[model samples]
Target: MKVKLYMATKSAKQQASIIGLLFAIVCFMSCQRSSNNLGVTENMEKDKTDVAEKIVLTDEEWKRRLTPEQYRILRQKGTERAFTNEMKHLGKGSFVCAGCESELFVSDTKYDSGCGWPSFYDTVDKNNITQELDSSFSMKRIEVLCSRCGGHLGHIFNDGPQPTGLRYCINGGAIKFQKDDEDNK
Candidate 1:
């Protein structure tokens, strides 16, 4: 009787351990799936509204309006090589969307993040840009886009200087720098 009781108790404990592990795994997977689904749904809704308000261009029109490099980054959501873009060193200029030429970032908000991209603490206006949750490359990021044309600009991060503590890390190929008149003096 004693031997049987001991064996039964051990078996119950093992079953409990297995149940706990399985529960944990299920919870983790559920949370991941929910979050990913939420991001997709939210972006879809936002994009629908944004598309209604902005210029809707066909692929041929976009290809004609943008240069090859600009089209890659803006229309195709491609990233430019780090440290190879001239916009990173631009001074006293306003950066406009390469797709629609809408004003996006000002020189005053630009900062050197040393991340081989044009970093900004702020934008020309909140209405000029849209952010969507991007889960590409097996990582999650907030993707910035031009509000006027829905062009992919880059990603925004939280690690940045004071005031906003937000970094708008933009691809140079996605924007055009127009020097401020004062800078020419």
Candidate 2:
């Protein structure tokens, strides 16, 4: 039907009822949408979830937040030379996000595959990385990225040396060395 708002005086209980009714009406109206709008929304959401990376940044901002090596590896997806990662020391600690400083790999997940890059048996959680099909090379492969900022981290392979058959061969320059502070005690 129709809704009307009046400035006329009314009892407190009536006024409260009117307010509640208006709220319900607003909620109902907001739920209505055209089919075309729904289709467009579905497409938009699909595109967003597919490859909407939040790693976009100004050149200056990127430079300030990362070292030259880190910037090159993360933004460019360039791999560091074999045997150059500081994590090679095998220190115990959280392997945090190189871009946003969020923890993506814990010390327990870290494992050595002897392929040169620091590999992980598992990520901190599924929210930690985005996996996508990569065919840039002649071969098809899976490229792994930071889920939070979408920074290029590395690749995951089914072949791994461990109890877990999966290996997350992350880019060395894409991670930072944060030794566990508790080790000092």
Per-residue CA lDDT of model 2 for 83-127, tens digit only, reads 667786556878877886757788788877766777887877666
- lDDT of every predicted structure (CA atoms): 0.78, 0.67
Predicted structure 1: lDDT: 0.78
lDDT (tens digit, per residue) of candidate 1 on 62-157: 889889999899999998766678865567889999888889999889988777778888888777888888887575667889888889998777
Best by TM-score: 1
Cα shift from native, residue 124, model 1 (Å) = 1.2
Scored against the true structure, residue 20 in model 1 reaches a CA lDDT of: 86
How far out, in Å, is residue 130 in model 1? 0.5
Best by lDDT: 1
